[model samples]
Target: SELHEKVKLHYNNFKGDPKDVKEMKERIEIEDE
Candidate 1:
């Protein structure tokens, strides 16, 4: 959970692009599976 939060924060700081965020989330989901 901490890692996820940190990643989200990092991403938010660098690229606050919704599309990229969504894509990253999707990639994370796939990795999780």
Candidate 2:
């Protein structure tokens, strides 16, 4: 749950920037693997 919270915080930090959000999503996906 802590990881999820961290991810949420990251999302908030990247909010309103589609490019950053996309990069974040890619990073998360790689981490998931």
Candidate 3:
């Protein structure tokens, strides 16, 4: 599916901005916890 591919692409290309990546991970962890 396009959605699955897009997600994988985002993860692969996510090193564009360090702060953005860090914030995203923090948010995801907070939600999971």
Report the candidate with higher TM-score, 2 versus 3: 2
**Judged by TM-score, which candidate is best?**
2
Which runs of model 1 end up more than 4 angstroms from their true locations?
Answer: 1-15
Give the lowest summed-lDDT range of ten residues in model 3: 24-33
lDDT of each: 0.70, 0.76, 0.65
Clashes of each: 0, 0, 0
lDDT tens per residue, model 1, 1-33: 677777666666766578888888776666545
The number of the candidate with the highest lDDT is 2
Q: What tens digits encode model 2's per-residue C-alpha lDDT throughout 1-33?
A: 579669868777775679879888888767766
- Candidate 3 lDDT score at position 18: 84
TM-score of each: 0.54, 0.57, 0.52
User: Candidate 2: TM-score?
Assistant: 0.57
Residues 1-33, candidate 3: write the lDDT tens digits.
Answer: 565556556656787688888776665556544
Task: Give the higher-TM-score candidate: 1 or 2.
Answer: 2
